[model samples]
Target chain A: MNTNSDYPKRICSTTGFPICRSAEFFVKANAVLGVVFLLIGGIAAILIALTRWQAVHLLPVDWFYRILTLHGINMLIFWILFFEVAILYFVSTTLLKVRLASRLTAWISLVMMFVGAVMVDVTILLGKADVMLSSYLPLLAHPAFYLGIILVAVGTLIAVGNYFATLYIAKKEKTYEGSVPLVVFGATAAAIIAVVTLLHGAVVMVPTFLYSLHLCPQPDPQWYRLLWWGLGHMSQQVNVCAMVAVWYLLAAITTGAKPLNEAVCRSAFVLYILFINLASAHHLLVDPGVSAGWKIWNTSYAMYLAVLASMMHGFTVPASVEVAMRGKGYVRGLFGWLTNAPWRNPGFSAFFLSLLIFGFIGGITGVTLGTQQINIIAHNTLRIPGHFHATVVGGTTLAFMGLTYYVVPLLWRREYILKPLCRLQPYLFGIGILIMSFGMSFAGSMGVSRRSWDIDAGGSIYGPTAHLFLALVGIGGTVAFIALFLYVGLTVGTLLFGRRIAAGKSMEDWGTPKVLSTSPGHDHVAPAPGFAGGATVAEAHPTQGTMVLAVIFLLSFAVYYFANWKALADVWPVR
Target chain B: MNQESSSGLECPKPGWFQAPSGNERTWIGMAVIWCLILSVMMPYWHFRGKQNSTGEAYRVKPADFVKRVEAFVKVNTGEESLVEDGIAPVVPAPPGEVYLLAKQFFWFPVLKLRSGETYRLHISSADVQHGFSLLPMNMNFQIVPGYDHVLTIKPQAPGTYHIVCNEFCGIGHQQMVGKIIVE
Candidate 1:
C-alpha cells in the first residue's frame, strides 16, 4: 500500500481504494444532498404523474406546473449533478489513487450549489416561478430563479475545473497507467459536456436575470429557446454520459466486468464529447425561425454519432458482464453467462436494469422521437416527458440508485440496512418505470398535452381513449411512486443507521471487480497465477450471446421507428 | 489489504491505448452504418414523406398578424363559432394563407376548411411562444412570435379537430384551445 497519507487520508482495506478525508467529506456531503433532492423530486414526480392521470387529478393547474418545475430542477439538475460530482471526485481521487485537487474550492462549490438549489425551490414553491421547466420568454419569473440557476451552473463549472486539475495532478504524480481508466475517461466526457452546457446557462440566465431586474430589454423568445436548450437538453446529455459511465463502473464493481475492448470504449467516449449534445436541437425541431438545415444537421447527421456511441456501450457493457461471468466458470452455453449473473445484488441488478431500460425503452424511443418530422408529433406532447422519463428516470436515476448501494458500504464504510429490501429495490423500481413509461407514451400518442393540468381541457372531450391510457398512466405512476418511496426510505435508512463493514474488506470480497482489461475468452492467467491466490479462468467462451441480444435490440429499435413514421404518415394525406 | 492484480486479469502495460481485437472494429463499422442510415432517413422523410414542410415563413409583428387574422375572419365564408372548450371565439377562415394567432391562453381565427383541399395555415404567437397541437391527428408545431409557421394541411374526411396549446406559455396554457371544422 502507498501509505503516503500525509494529506489526511487512509487506504481503504476492503477495496484498496484510498479514502481521503477531504474527498470523503465532499463525496458524503454531495451524496447526501443528492439523495435529499432525489427524495423531494421523486415525491414531486409522483404528484405530477398522478395529476396527469385524469381520474385522480391530484394538483390544481397552478400547483401542477409548480411541482413540475421543482421536479425538473431537483431530479434532473440537483440530484443527478450532485451525485455526478461525487462520482467525479471518486473516480479522480480514489480510482486513480490521488488526492482531490483542491478541497476548499470543492466545499465552496457544494455550498453554492446547495444554496442555489434551495433558492430556486423557494421561488417555485412561492408560486413566483411557475413558468414550467422551459420557462419560455416574455413569461418572466422571479430574478432569484434565474440567479439560482446561474449559481448552480457556476458551482458546477468550478467542480469541473477541480476535476480537470485533479487529473493533471494525478498525471504529474504518475498514479496509474495507460489513458486514466475507462470510468474516468467516461467521467471526463461528462465533464466536458457540463462545461459547454453550463456556459449556455450563464449566457441565457445572466441576461434573463438582468431582464427581470429591468436592466435589459425583454429577451427574444426564439433566442432564449435556442440558448436555453443548449443548457436544458444538453444537461440531460451530460447525465447520459455520466450515467453510462456509472453503468461501466458499477458493472465492474459488482460483477467483475470490464469492457470487451478498452480502446472501443474510449473511442465511444470521444464520439460522445464530440456529438452527443447536438441532439439538444431536437428540442427546437418544432420551433419556427430555425432553418430546417440546422435542425436536420443537428437532429440527424451529428446526433447520430451520440446514438452510435450509446449503441457501442449497450453492447460492450453487457458483453463485459457476460464475458466476466463466463470467465468465472459459467461457461456453458451462450446464455450461461447471463444466467449466472449476480441478480441478487442490488448493485448488479441496478446496472442491468439501467442497461435494459435505457437500451430497449429509452434509446429506441429517443432516436425515433428525436427525428425532425417525428418531433412535430412527440415534441410538446406527453411523449416528450415519456421518452425522457425512460432515459433520465429509468436509465440514469436507477443507475444512480443502484450505485448508491455500493457507495454506502464502500465510501461511507457502512453495511447496508434492510438487505432484503435492497435486493428487491431495482426490480420493483424497474417494473414501476416500465409501466409508467408505457402509460405516458400511450397517453402521449393519443395527443394528451405535455404541460396541461387537465386532459379534458375544461371538458373539451379528447374521448375516453385518452382517459383510458391516462388512467394507465395513473396506475403506472402509483406503482412507480411506491417503488420510489421504498428506494428513498431504504437509502436514507442505510445511510443514517447501517452497520459498519468488517475490517480488511476494502474491495476484496466486493465482487472482485476486474475492470482493468476486457480480453476475450479465458487466456487470462492473472499475469502470475499464484501471486495473490488468483484463479486462472481457462475456458474459451463464445461471445455470440451478446451478439444475439444486440440484434434483438436493433430489431426493437427499427420496429418502433417505423411505427412512428406510419403514425406521422397517417396524420395527413400526401401533398 | 487488496492486491494490485485484481483491477485487471491481464493488466495492459503502462501505455496500452489500442485494442488489438477485431470485435471493436466490427462494432465501429456497425456504428458508422447506423449513423449513415439515420442521416439519410431525415432527408428522405423530408422530401418523400407526407409530413414535408410547406417551405413557408414571412416575418410579421404580433399586432399586424392579429389584424390580418381579423381581416381574414371578416371576408371568409364561414359561420362564426366558439371552439369546443367554449373558451375562445374562433372565426373560421377560408382556404388562402389563413392567418392565425396564439397568445397566453387561446388560439384565434380557427379554420373551417374543405375536406381534401390544401390550406396554408399560418400560425404565430402574440406573446411568448405557444404550441399549435391538433389532437387525435397528433400534428403539432411551435407558435413563436415575430416568425410565422406556415403549415399546409388537408384534413381528410370532414370533422371537428381540436387544437390544444401543448407548449407552456402560461398558467392558462391548458385552456388555450382552438378548433378546425372540416367541411
Candidate 2:
C-alpha cells in the first residue's frame, strides 16, 4: 500500500482514463450546454412574461404555444438531461475510481441527442406543431417532432447502457468492493427509472405518430393519458433522484462533509423509488373516469411518502451543512452559521437557497394541489408552471449550477474567471424567482388563467389585477434572465481563458490548500481487507461476466420494443 | 486539563414576536412594517369576502354544503333522466346559501334547488391551476394563472353550471368538469 506522502499527485497509471481528464471533458460539455439552453429558454420565458404584462399579444397563438413548449422542454428537460449525463461521468470515474466503459459509445450518444434536440427545435419553430410541452393527445404535431423525441430517448438508452457496462467492468476489476459508491448507486437508480420511462414514451409516441399520418383512426385518449404520464411522471422522479445525489456530492466537495447518517440518506432515496411513480396521479386529480378511490390512494396518501423524502433531505442536508460550518468555527447560534458562513462560496450558497425556495413554494403547492377537490380548480393555470419552476428551476437547476462551479474547476484543473460574479449570480436569481413566483400565485388566485393570449376578457372584473401581476412577473423574469446570462458568461469565460494549473499540482492542492500534515484527520487509514487485496488480480484479467449482463439488459429492451411495435401494428394495420 | 463547557450557558431569548439580531432582524422589521401597512389598507382592498350580486355571501359553510350535497344526490339521482342527461338535477339551496368546491382545475357544484331561480357563482382553487369557468356562458377566471391561487365566476343568471374544462388536462382531463342546471 502506498504511504500518504507517496500518493500520486498526477493522473492514475492504470489507463488514459484519469479522473481529471474525464471530469474536465464532462464538465466542459455540461457547462456549454447548460449556458446555451438557459439562454434560449430564459429569453423565451421573458418574452412571454413581458408580452403578458404589456397586454400585447406579441406571440401569435402558434408562436405563444411553441415558445411555452420549448421554454419548458429546453430548460427543464434538456438542461437537466445534459447535466445528469455529465454528473454520471464524474461519479463513475472520479468517485468510483474507474474509466467509462467506452468513450466512443458516449460520444455517439451525445451526437444523437444533440441531433434529436435540434430537430425538435426546428419543428417547433416552423409552426408545424404547437402542442405545448405536455403534447396531450388529439392535439397533433408534425411527424418530425415525434421522431426527434424517439431519437433522444434512444440516445439516452444507449448512455444508460454504457453506464452499466462501465460499472460491471469496474466491479469485475474490483476497483471498489461490495456495495457501489453512494453517488453511483443513486445515479443507477435514476438510470433504471429513465429506462422504464423512455420505454413508456415509445408506447405513447409511436402510436401518436402513426395516428397523425392517418395510419390509425385515432389513439385512445385514456390509453394515451396513462402512457404519457408514465413517461412524464417517471422522468421527473429521475430528476428528483439525480438532484438529491448532487446535494450529497456538493456537500462532499464544498466542506468535505458526508451525511451524518448514511442510512437516512439511503432510505430517502429508497422512499423516492417506491413513491414517485404513484404520485403522478396527483396531476389527474380533477380528471373524470378514474375511480375516486384510486385518485385518493395515488394522489393524496401515496405522494406524502415522496414529500417525506424531500422534507427529510431538506432537514438532513442543512444539518450536515450546520455541522460542517461549526467545524469551521462559525459557531455563533443555532442558525448563526447561515449568516457567518461564506456566502461567496457559490456551491454552498446556491444549494442552500435552492433548497429553501423549493421547500417553501414547490412543496406547499405540490401538497395543496394533490388534493382531489383542490385539483379541480388548479389543474392547468399559470400556477402549474409557477409550482414546477420552484421545484425544477429553483431546486434542480440551481443545484446543477452550484455543482458546476466546483466540478468544472476541479475537472479542468483551472481557476474560475470571475469568482466574485459566480458568488453574486445565485442571489440575483433567487430573489428574482421569489418575486416572479409570488406574483404568479397572486395572479392565479385572482383567476388569471394560463396560456391565454389576452388578460382582458371583455368585462371580467379581475382584468386589472391580472394585468398588474403579469407585469410584475415580467419584471421578475427579466431580472432572472440577466442573472442567468451573467452566470453563463462567467462559466464559459473561465473554461476558455482561466489560468491553467501546474501539471504536478492536484486540484485539491491548488485551491485554498489545506495543511495535510497538521490537520487532525490527516493520517492515512489503510484500506479494509477485501478491496485492496482483490484490486491487483482483478485489474490483470479480462472477464466475460460483464458482457453477459449487458446482453441481458439489451435483450430486455429489444423484446419490449418489439412487443410495443406488435401491439401498435395490431391496432393500426400498415395497409 | 478540564475544559470549560460551552453548552451550560443559557442562550438569551429574544422577546416573543421580536426580530432576531443582524441582517435577519432587518428582514423581520421590514416584514412587520409591510404587514401593518396591509392591515391599514385592508378596508380599501374592496374584494375581500364581499357578497355576490344575488345578496348571498361568497363563503359557504362546509357542514351545510355536505348536508346539501347529500340531500341533492338522494333526490335528483332518484330520477332516471337526471342520470341520463349527465347533469346534476337541481335541488334546493337554503334561503341565501352558496355551495363552493375548492378544486385544482375547475369548479364542480351540485346546485340544491329544484326551483328555476338564478344564483351567483364565485369559485376558486386553493393552490395552483384553477378555472372558475362556465363555458356555455363564455366566462373564465385564471386563478394564480401565473403562480398563485386563482378564483373564477359565473352568475346564476345562466341557470346552470356550464362545466367547461378550461385548462389542458393530459387527455381525459377535459371530461372531468360537469354541470348543474336549475330545473
Candidate 3:
C-alpha cells in the first residue's frame, strides 16, 4: 500500500503524518474555497454591522436584508462546511495513514459544492431569496435557492461518504495499529453529525423546493422549523465536534499534548454523536405546536448529557495542555503552566482563546437561552446571534484559523509572510468577537431585534443605551473584519509569495516553546499500558490550574444561568 | 494509557481505555451534577415559574386568523381617536380574549389592556411567519402563519410595550411594530 503509485502518498515533513496526494489536493481545494467564502461573508459582516449601528445605518433596507441573507449562508454553511469537508478529508487520510477512498468522488463533491454555493450567492444577491438562512417555509425563496442548498448538502454527504470509505479501508488494510487516534475519533463524530444534518436538509429542503416551484402544498411552517433546525442547529454541532478535534490536534501540534484518558475523551465524543442533534430543539423551544414536555425533554438533551460531554471535553482539552506544559517543566505554580504557555504561537493563542470564549460566553449563554422559559427572553433577538457568533465564529472559525497556521507550512509548503501580524491575528479576532457578542447580548436584552433593519423604523425608539451597544457591535465587527482580512490576506500571500520549504526538509518551526527537559517519560506521568486494567490512582501530575479554571467556568455558568432566569421572571407573566 | 511512537501521529496501543483520574475525575463529577441541575430547572419552572410557554396553539388558515383578528378589533373598539396609525385600530379590551395578527409589514390592531388583569392573547400571522417580540420586556415567541398561538398574559407594569417583528418576514420587517398599552 505504501509503494502503490496509484494512491501516491508522501510523508508530511514537519508532522511526519502520511499525506496522500489526492486527499491533500482535496484538503487544499476545500480550504481555499472556504477562505474565499469567508472573504465574502466578512465583507457582508462589516456592512451589516454598520447598518445595524443606527449611527451608520450603512445599507438601505432591501440590500441590508439581501446581504444579510448572503452573510448567513456564506458564513454559516459555506465557509464552515467547506472547511469541515477539508478537515474530514485530512483526518481520514492523514491521521489514519490511508489514501482518500476515491479521488473522483472527492473532485465531484467539491465541484458540486462550489457550483451550489455560487448559485445560492447569486440567488440571494439577485434578491430572489430574501428568506434568511433558515429559509423557513411559507416565506418562500426562489427555487434556485433550495436547489442550491440541496446540491451543497448532497455534495457534503458524498464527501462524508468518501471519509467513511477511507476510514473503513484504513481499518481493513491495517494502515495503522490499534484504534484510530483521538483526533480521528472526534472527526468521525463530526462526520456522523454531518450525515444526520445533511439528511435533515434533504427532508426539509426537497419539499420546500417543490413548493417554491408550485409542485406541492406549502409544508407547515411549524414542521419546517422542527426539521429545518435539525439541519441548522445540528450543523453547528458538527462545527463543535470539528472545533474540539482541532483543539486537540492543535494542542498536540503546539504543546505535544496527549489525551489524559482515551476512554473519557472517546466517551465524550460518543455522547456528542448520540445526543448532540437533540440540541436543535433549542431553536424551536418557544415555537408553537411543540408541547412543554417535548420541548423540555428535547432541549435538555435527556438530562443534558450532551452538555456534560462538552464540559468534559472543555476540561480534558486544557487539562491535556496543562499536563503537557507541566511536563515541559512549567510547573512553578497552579497557574505557571498557563502563564508560560506559547502565547506567541498563533495556533496556541487562537486555540486557547477560542476555548475560553466558547465555554465562558457561547456555551453559558446558549444553555441559559435554550432553557424552555428563558427562550421567551431570547428568541429571534440579537441575543441569538450573540450566542452563535461566539460559538461558530469565535470558537470554530478561530480554531480553524489556528490549524491553518500549521497547515500552510505543512501542506502548502509555504512560510507565513508577516510574522508579527500572524501573532496578533487571534487576539484581534478574539477580542473583537468578545466585544461584539457582549454588545449583541446587552442590546438584545434591551429588545433590539436580530434581523431588524431599524429598531426605530416603526417609530418605537430604543433608548441611548441600546444605541450605544449597537455602536459596540459596529466597532467590534469592524475589528473582527480587519482581523479576518489580515488572516485571509496572510494565508493567500503566503501561498503565493512566502518562502517555500525545501523538498524533503522539515518545515520551519512556528514558535514552539523551549522545554526544560528533553526527556518525555518523567514529566508526562501516566499509568503504562501494562496497568490499563486498574491504575487510575497511578495517574499523577494533577491539572490543578485547569481545575481552578473549570471551577471558575462553572461559577460563571451558574451566575449567567441564574441571571437569565431572574430576567425571565421579571418579564410579563405569561403561560 | 497507551504508548506512542516517536512521531506521535500513530494510533494508541490496542487497549487504551482508562478511567479519568485526579482533577479530570473531579471536574467530570461536578459537571455531571451541574447538568442534572440544569435538566431539573426547566420542568421545575414549568410547575412553579411565572413565565412558561405552554405552547397552547391550534391550526388555522391565514385568512381565517385574519378574519378572527378583525372581528376582535371591531368588537373591542370604543373610541375613534384610538386609531393612531391610519388603518391600525387601537382596541381597549377587558380581561379575557384578545387577538393580534402579524403580517409581512405590520402587526394589526394596537392592543390596550389594564395592568394586573389576565388576557388570553391569540397571536397569528396573516401571511408569512413573523416574530411576536414584545419589546422592553424582551419576551418573544414565533408567530407561524397557520397557527393561532395563545399566550395568557398579565401585564404587571403600566407602560406602552412595542411589538417588534424580530423574524425576517419580508423587506419591511423593521417597520412591522405594534403597540400594547397597559394602563
Tens digits of per-residue lDDT for model 3, B22-67: 7888888999899989989998999999999989999998899889
Each model's C-alpha lDDT? Answer: 0.79, 0.57, 0.88
Which candidate wins on TM-score?
3
lDDT ranking, high to low:
3, 1, 2
lDDT of 1 by residue, A1-575 (tens): 33334567777886666677788889889988998998899889889888888888999888999999999889889998899999998888887778898989998899899999999999999999988778888889999999898889999899999999988887777776655777888899999999999998899999999999999998888889888989998899899899988998888777776566666677788988888667668888877767777888888637488888888888878877776766666655778778767788888888899999988999898889888888877878888778888999889989998888888788777777778888898898888888888888888888887878886774555888778878877787778778788988887787689777677765324344333354566443333333321122111334668878887887788888888888888887522
Model 1: TM-score, first chain: 0.93
The 10-residue segment with the lowest total lDDT in model 2 chain A? A566-575
Chain B global fold similarity (TM-score) for predicted model 1 against the true chain B: 0.81
Query: How well is each residue in A1-575 modelled by candidate 3, as lDDT tens digits?
Result: 53333578888877677789989999999999999999999999999999998999999999999999999999999999999999999888888778899989999899999999999999999999998898887888889999999999999999999999999888888777777888898999999999999999999999999999899998888999989999999999999999999998988888877777778888999999999888878988888888999999999988899999999999988988887777677867788889898999999999999999999999999999889999999999899899999999999999999999988898999889989999999999999999999999999999898998998888846999999999999999999999999999999999999998998888777777677763544455543434432124225456889899999999999999999899888988999
Off by over 4 Å in 3: A1-6, A517-538, B1-9, B81-93
By DockQ thresholds, what CAPRI class is model 2?
A: incorrect
Off by over 4 Å in 2: A1-27, A54-58, A301-303, A457-461, A506-575, B1-165, B168-183
DockQ, candidate 1, comes to: 0.43
- Stretches > 4 Å off in candidate 1: A1-5, A301-303, A502-540, A573-575, B1-15, B19-24, B77-95
What is the DockQ (computed on Cα atoms) for candidate 3?
0.62
Chain A TM-scores, one per candidate? 0.93, 0.83, 0.97
Residue A487's lDDT within candidate 3 is: 98
Quote each prediction's TM-score.
0.93, 0.69, 0.96
